[model samples]
Target: MSAPPLNPKAGLRAALLLLLCAVALVSITAAPAAGAGPGSPDSRRGDRTVVRTEQGLVRGLSHGSYTTFDGIPYAAPPTGPLRWRAPVPATAWQGVRDATRPAERCVQMPAPGASGVTGSEDCLYLDVTVPTAEPAAGKRPVMVWMHGGAFLGGSGSDYNAGRLSVQGDAVVVTVNYRLGIFGYFGHPGLGAAPPFGLADQQAALRWVRANAVRFGGDPRSVTLFGESAGALGICAHLTSPTAAGLFQRAVLQSGSCLTSFPRGALAPGTPAYEPFAPEAEVQMVGTRAARQLGCTEGGNEEVLACLRGRSTDRLATAQLMQSFNRPAFGNGLLPEAPARALASGRFHRLPVMLGTNHDEMRMFVGLSLAAFPIRTEGDYRARLTEAFGAAAPAVEARYRAADHPSPALAWAAVLTDRSFTCTTLAAGRTIAEHAPGLSLHGYEFDDPHAPVLAGLPANPDFPYGAAHGFEMPFLFTPFPTERPLDEAQRTLSDRMVAYWTAFARTGNPNSTDAPPWPALRMSSPHAPSVQSLAPEPGGIHPVDAYATHQCSFWDRLSR
Candidate 1:
C-alpha cells in the first residue's frame, strides 16, 4: 500500500490494526487442528512408513496419493531458559519418533469464538508432505509454506498440502514459529538477538537443507512461499544476510516489503500501517510490557528472568501480544527494515513471484463495515478526509463512490489500490531494479466469484469478490471454503498448481498448459507485465496492475 505519514499515537493504532488483519486468516476454520507432542499415539502405526532426518527417523502416515510426516521438531523448544534466545538444534531422539499428528500450535492470540489464549510455547515444529508418486526422474522440488496470522496466530500444520504436493509432484513443508509476544518480543538485555519467530523459520530451512534429499527432494531446489504475515516473514528473510542459500526461489502472496495501509484504511482515525518496526522501538514496547507485568525494579537479567517466569496466560493477553506483532529490524536477522533494504538493493537476488487479490481490501473493509459504517458518499468523503487530510479531495476525485455499487465498496477499492495492489507491484519493481537478471514474475488472483472462506462475516449486498485469501483453496487442500468450487474453479486450481510447481522446478512459472505469464518490466512506468489469474476463459492473461490500480496517483500522494 502507499505509505501515509503518521503521528506517534496513530502509529500505535495502525500497528494494532495491522495485527487485526490476521483476523482474515483466523476466520478460516478449515486448517487441521494441531495435536500433542511425542506422546500422542500413532493411529496409523500399522501401515505408516519412516523417513530419516539428519537428527533421527520419523514415521509418517500414508494417505494413498501422498505421505505426511507431521509435527517434526526443527529446533529445541524455545521454552523456559531458551525463551527470548535464538533457536538451537533440536535434540536428537532415539528410535522412530511419532509424526502422525501435529504438534501444539505456537502461543498466539485466541481466534474468534475461542476461550483463553490457545496453543503451547513449545511450538517450533514443521511438517513434510510428499507425493506418493515421486517425479518420473530425479528429486522433486521442495516448497516450504509459512502460514499467515498477523504473527499472532496460525500453525504450520493447519494447511493440508496434500493437494499441492500430489498435483505438483513436489515435496511441501509447512512451519510453525513463535507468535506475538513470545516470538517478536525484544529487550535491551537480549543485545542484537534476532526475532525468534524469524530465527525459527531459518532453523526450519536449515532442517530442510539437511534432510530434503532423504525425502526425495532437491535440497538446493527449494521455494519459500507464504501469504499475509507469512509473506512479511519471507520479506524479512529476503533481506536477511543470514538467509543466503536457504532457498532458490520465493513466492510472496498478499504481502510485500512496502505493503502498508493508509490512515483510516481499517477504521476512521487509524494511522498508516506497515508490518515492520525498528529494533529500538520494539525494545521500548517490550520494556513497557515488562513493567506492566510488574517485572519492574530490576536490572536486565532480573527483569528478563521475572518476565520469563511469568505464566503464558499472563503474557498472551490480547493487548500485550498484539502490541508486539510487528517484527523488529536492526538485529542480526534483520539489520534494517525490509522496505528500506529492498529500496537500497540489499536483498537476496533470487527468482521471486509476488501478488495480491484483485479485491484485496474488501475482506478487511467488509468485516469492519458493521463497526465503521460508510453508507453514502458523504461517509466515504469523511473517511478520505480522516485518512488523507489535505489530499482527501485528490483521492476522492480518483475513487468516487458513484463509480462502485456502494460507498463501502468504493472505500474498499481505495484501500486495495493504495495498500495491497500498488505496494506489491512496487516491491516487484524494487526487486527488478536491484537484480535486473533475476527471474521475476507477478500475478493478480482476480477470480471475482472466488469462494469465501468459512466464518467470514460478509454482507449479502457486498460480495467479497476475489478478496484477500480467497485464492488459497486453489492451491492448498482442506482450506474450508464456505462452499465447494464448481467445475470451472476446480479447473483453474489445476492451472495454478501447474504454474506454481513449474516455477519451483525451474524458477519459471510458464508452461505449455497455461497462458504465458509475462515478466514485470523493471523500467516501465506502467509495468503491465503481471498475469491475471481467474477461472473464466481468457482470464489468465497479463494486465498492467500498476496502471490499472492507479498506483501513479498513490505514488504521488505518498510523496
Candidate 2:
C-alpha cells in the first residue's frame, strides 16, 4: 500500500510518541532479570568469594571465569535532607553484606509506560568484576566505568563486566550515582561544587582506592573510562582540581570537552545543547522548579526542606529531571567550563585516549525521522538552514544530498560531521597543543555491520553504521543487541580489548601483538593520525582525521 503524505503536526506527535516508546524500550533492555545475582548458583555453593572493604565485609558471586561483587555502597544515599548536597561516605556496617544482587539505580524519571521510577534516592553503589584466576604476582590494572544516559538515566549494574575482566585481565568497577534533578540541581541552598553526581563518582573512586587490593587490582593503576555523558564526566574530572590523583589515565568515547550540539541537530525543533551550565542559570531553573513544586514560600533552608519533603515520584518526572540535566560550573568541582579550561591548558597533564564513532548522529537522526520526515531535497535544505543558519547554503553545498542514499542519511552525515566528528578532532588537537608532553591517542570505530542495539527500529535504507554507543559491546559482554558478533567481529573485539587494557596498564594503547596506534603528536608533519577499528581484515589502520571529517570547514564555522 502507498504511504499517505506526511502532515507536520501528525509527524511531530508520532515522533513524540516514538521517543517515549524508545525510552520505555531502553528501560526494558536496561532492567536486570528476575533473580540473577552477581554469583551463579554453583559459585554460591562451590567457590564463595568474600572481600573486605573499609566499611565491611561482602560476599561476591563466582562465575566460571570471573567473580562479580555487586551492590556495594560507596557513599550514603542522597535522600531527604541530603538532596542536592555532596555525597557523604558510606557508614561502616557489621556482618558480611550480600553483594550478589545489583542495587536499585538512582532515582530517575520512569520511562514512558513504566509504572513508576525504577530506582531509589539512596543509590550510591559500585560493582566490581575480577578474573577468577589470580595473576602471578602483580595486581591487575583497574578500569572504572561510568555509564552514559545524557546524565539523566542509566545505572552501573546495567552493564556486565565479565568480558572486560576476563579477556582484558583487568578488574572492572561500574558505579551508580545520583541522576537528573537529584544529582545536578543547584540553588542558593546548595553550596558550590560541580553536582552531586560528579561528587558521587569521586566518592566511588575513593572507595576503589581503599578496596581494589581485595579484588586483585592495583589502586594506583586505575583507569577512568566512559562513553558519551560518562566521557564528559571524565572531562570534568580531568579539569577538576579535587580530582587530581584519583586516576592515572583516562579514555573518552564519543564525547569531549568541546562536544556541543547545534540547534535542530536532533530533530526539527530541538534546541542546541551544552553539556555544562553556569551555576546562576542552574540556580534559576532550580528556583523555578521550586516554585512549581510549591516550595518557594520560605527562606532558603525552609525552601530546601520543602523540596526535600516532596515525594521522589513528584520530582522524578521527565520534564523535571531534564531541567537539571546540565552540571553547574563556578564551583570547587569545575571553576570554569571544561572546554575553556582545556583551551587555556588548565587541565591535568595525563595520557588520554579520545574518539567518536564513524556515524555518531545516525542513531539520533534515524529515530527522529518518523516524527519529522526529511524525505525530499527541500526538506534537507530546511533542516540545514535551521541548524547552520546563514551557513546553511554552504553546508548544503558541501554535503550534497544527491551523494547519499537518502535525505535522512545526508542530514545524519551533516550533523555527524559538524557536531561529533569535527568537535572531537578539534578537542584532540587542542589537547595535543596544550599538553605537549602527554601521550594522546585518537580512534574511530567503523564496524559498518555492527549489531543493532535492542529497541531501535530497523531501517534498511539508513543503517546504524557504527553509531553512538555501538562500540560498547566489544568491551563489555551481553550488551542488548539484536544478534551476537560473528567470528571476524570477535577477532576485532579481542584486539580492541587488548588495546584498551594495554592502554589502561601503561598509558599507551599499542602492544607487541596488536596493531600500533599512533599518538596525536603536535610536532608531527602529517595530519593527526586516528586508528580505524573495524571487523574486516586490514580494517585497523591510521587515517588523517582532519581530512576525513573536513575539520577545517568546521573550525572556520565554529570560529
Candidate 3:
C-alpha cells in the first residue's frame, strides 16, 4: 500500500538525494492509464480541438457540440524535493502537446476492491471542457470543480463535464490536487504549511484567472463548486484570505464549514470526525509518523531529508495515507477553523448555495450494515446512545424507530439529520445572519428514488435514496450509475444544470424554465425557504429546512 514515492522531475531543482533515487521513476515512460475511455489516443483530433494556454499549446478531442482537453499540468509535479512545498508554476513546453488523455490520479487509498494503492504523486493536472458554439473569448461563465473522495481518492478526469459545458454554455475546468498523506500531511520541519491539496486548487484557480479567456470563459465569473470532501475544501477557501478574489460564487453540496460527525456515525465505536485539525496536533502526529517510518535519527531538516528520499512504496501504506486526511488550520491559508470563521462572519462576502441530500447517510450506513448491522431497535438505540450520549432519549423520541420502515433506516435518518443536514442548514443560516443583503440559498436533494451510484453494493431491504454524491451525475454528464436516468429524472437533470449554471452566471439559480428558488432569510420569524429538488411533479419546490430537519432540537442538544 506504500505509494508516497517521490515523483522525479527533469530540468528542475528537485532535492539532491531524490535526483539519484527517483530518476528511474521519471525516465521510464509508462503505458497510457487504464480505463482512459472515449477520448483515447485513438480518438479523432482536429485543429478545432487545439488551444493555446499559458504554458503552451495543447490539442484535445472534438465531440461536435463540445471539446475536451485533458492532462494539462497546472503546477510543477510535486515530486522529489518539491513534495511538501507550495506548488510551483508549471514549466512551459514546446510545440503542441497531446492532451487527449488524463494523467495518473494522485496517490490514493485503494478503491472498494483494489489490490493496493493506485495513482502517482506527479498528478497535479486539470481537464477542460468547452462548448463548441461558445468558442468566442470571454463569452461564457467558468466552473472549477473539485472532486469528492474524502480527500483520499478521485481524479478530475473521472468526471465528464460535456453536459455542463454544452447545455449550460460554460467552460468547465475539473482539477486534480494532491490527496491523502501526500496532500494533507504536516510536519514540524514545515512551519505552518498550508494543505498542499487546497493550495493546488488555488493554483488551478489562478490558472483559470489567467487562462479562462483563452478557453471562452470570463475570468471574473469563476464559480467554485464541489460535493463531499470537495465541498469541504471550498468551505475552507470561503474563509481563506489567500483564496480571496479567486472565485465569485460558491456551491457546496452535502458538505459545509460546520460538517462534523459524532462518534459511531460511520461504525460502532468510531471516533467523532472533524474535517480540519489544529496545526500543532497535525505536526505532532507527523513527527510520530516520521519516527515510525524510521526517519528519527536527526533534527527536522535531516528527518525531512530522510523522509523525502524514501521510496513511494515505503510511504504509501494504508496507515500513513489514511492518517492525514483532515486539513490543518492556524496557518496563512486558514487563520482559524472554517466553522469558527464562518460562525464569526469572517468568510468571503459572496453568493453561496449549500445543501445536503434527503437521505445523506444511507450510503454510509448501507455500506457498513454488512459488518455492523443495525437490524433491531436495540441496535439503533445503542448507536443513538454512543452518538448522542445523555441526549440519546430525546433524540430517540424525536426520531423513533417505529416511525421508519426499519431500524437501519431510522439510524440513517438520525445521522443524516445530526451530521449532514442540520450542519449544512446551520452554516447557511449563519451566512444569512452575517450578510443579510448578500444572496444565501439552501437546498435538499429530496429525490427518494435516485439510481444506485458510485459502485455501492446494493441491498434490497435498504434503498439508497438520494444519498451522498447521488447528485453528481446530474451536475456532470456520464457519472457512473447502475442505470441511466429516466424521462422525468433526465428532465430534472436538465433543470438542475440550468439552476447551477444560472447561479454561476448571475449568483442566482432561478430561470424562466424552472420554478423560482428564493434566497434564505435567516432573520425571518418563520422558517427559511430551502428549495427541495426531486423529479416528481411539484417536487422542485421550497421547504422549511430548519423545521423539517428538526435543527432547533439538534442545536439545543449541541449547546
Best model per lDDT: 1
Candidate 2 structure quality by residue, lDDT tens digits, 1-559: 0011122245343434444444333333333423333543443354447877899888887776787889999988788777777888889999888988789888765666678877899899999988887674599999999988777778888788888888888999999988888888878877675688998999899898989887889999999999888999999999999899899999999999999987777666655778888888888788888888899877998999999999999998766776777888899989999999999989888899998999988887777777688999999999999888999998888889998999889999887888888888888888888877788999999999998878887888789998888898787777788899889999999999999998999999999988789897545524648899999999998887677777788888888
Q: In angstroms, give how far residue 459 of model 1 lies from its true place.
A: 1.0
TM-score between model 1 and native: 0.94
At residue 271, candidate 1 shows an lDDT of 56
lDDT of 1 by residue, 192-263 (tens): 779889999999999999999988899999999999888999999999999999999999999999998767
Question: Model 1: how far is 528 from its true place, Å?
Answer: 2.8
Error of 3 at 392 (Å): 0.8
Clashing pairs in 2: 39-61
Off by over 4 Å in 3: 1-46, 135-138, 525-528
Model 2 root-mean-square deviation:
4.6
Task: Provide the overall lDDT of each model, using Cα atoms, as 2-decimal numbers.
Answer: 0.85, 0.82, 0.82
- For residues 151-203, could you state the per-residue lDDT of candidate 3 as single tens digits? 77777877778888988899999999998778988999999999989999999
Total residue pair clashes for candidate 2: 1
What TM-score does each of the candidates earn? Answer: 0.94, 0.93, 0.91
Pairs with steric clashes in candidate 3: 1-316, 2-316, 2-317, 3-316, 4-312, 5-312
